[model samples]
Target: LRETRSYTWGLVIPDLTNFGFASIARSLEAHCREAGIQLLIACSEDDPALEQRVVDNLISRQVDGLIVASSGHSDDIYARIHDRLPVVQLDRHIGESRLPMVISDACKATAELVRDMASECGAEIYYFGGLLDLSPSRHRLAGYELGLHRAGLEADPARVRHRDYQPSSGYQLMAELVAELGAPPRGLFTASFTLLEGV
Candidate 1:
């Protein structure tokens, strides 16, 4: 939008091997290049402390802006950078911070997925993902129930699983659901990309 070319940007991510994160970073790199900007990509290995350190490093390098994709270190990182540069939060949020955000509509996606599962397979819907401590987890669960209700089906509390958005957590919950329900729900919607790996 700034009709400028040849800017510099810092791309901070939790991990590089994560396909989703890498794809996002590459997309940003491509966009920057196409717009005549240069991007420096960095990874923090999902460690908040490392992310904070990376933030300082990037700032010192004098990058024009930052793209933080759901970091464990977002709160502190953004707090340090917000006053001086543009920081776009993707797939996460820090309350009341004046940072711009670009994120998928997770809640809406969850609701629609559940509703579709209910229709396609006549299956009981389960909402699974994220730590209970996270707002997105809570919101996605709410969306699941709301979607079920909209589809004229009430969510069976027994069918819903809450996990820590990890593959092991997802495996455990899937096992638990099978144990309790005596089978899979015919369709499962996972809010966590990691969980999807297990599913």
Candidate 2:
């Protein structure tokens, strides 16, 4: 018998149709190609059960590594095998996930955006964010609140909406907000481009 390297890895993400995720896949594929590793991508569609199934499938295939953008699932399932499997969480994370993570400074960036908007608009700001169950959404909302506090403004729960990341939801939320306020908001912050599309 001889030792062999399969030179493969698996990636699990919420949605392939999302521009952010697609761009990530492109860059990752290029880097993997340079290193002579085959990259296998799986879409979880933000479903915990489907994500687990894909992850298990990848593990069974004996891939050397995994990158996951989990959908509210804990890391306990992978904690036991990570020493051999090398699981890495990406973009999103479970609360205090045991796996190593690679995520951006979403909170800082969102807060900065809020400040700029407030400074320029001098109007009430409303945030259209995704499900708070995900880390990214929670961080962004926290940033929004922090930004308002820094601007000497109180955080208004009525102005902040936490919903799913879908254009239809975005559209409906905006419509209902306008109906409730009797006018369009002066300052608006949408968490994702897809959400912005609906606006």
The TM-score leader among the candidates is 2
Model 2 regions more than 4 Å off: none
Quote model 1's TM-score: 0.80
lDDT of each: 0.74, 0.86
Candidate 2 displacement at residue 100 in angstroms: 1.1
The digit string of per-residue lDDT tens for model 1 on 78-169 reads 76677777888876665544678787766787778778778875546676766654456666887788778778887887767775655787
The per-residue C-alpha lDDT of model 1 at residue 123 equals 44
| Stretches > 4 Å off in candidate 1 | 1-6, 72-80, 121-123
RMSD of each: 3.8, 1.5
Model 1, residue 50: distance off in Å is: 2.7
Record all residue pairs in model 1 with backbone atoms less than 3 Å apart, i.e. clashing: 6-36
Q: What is the TM-score of each candidate against the true structure?
A: 0.80, 0.94
Counted clashes in each candidate structure: 1, 0
Model 2 has a clash total of 0
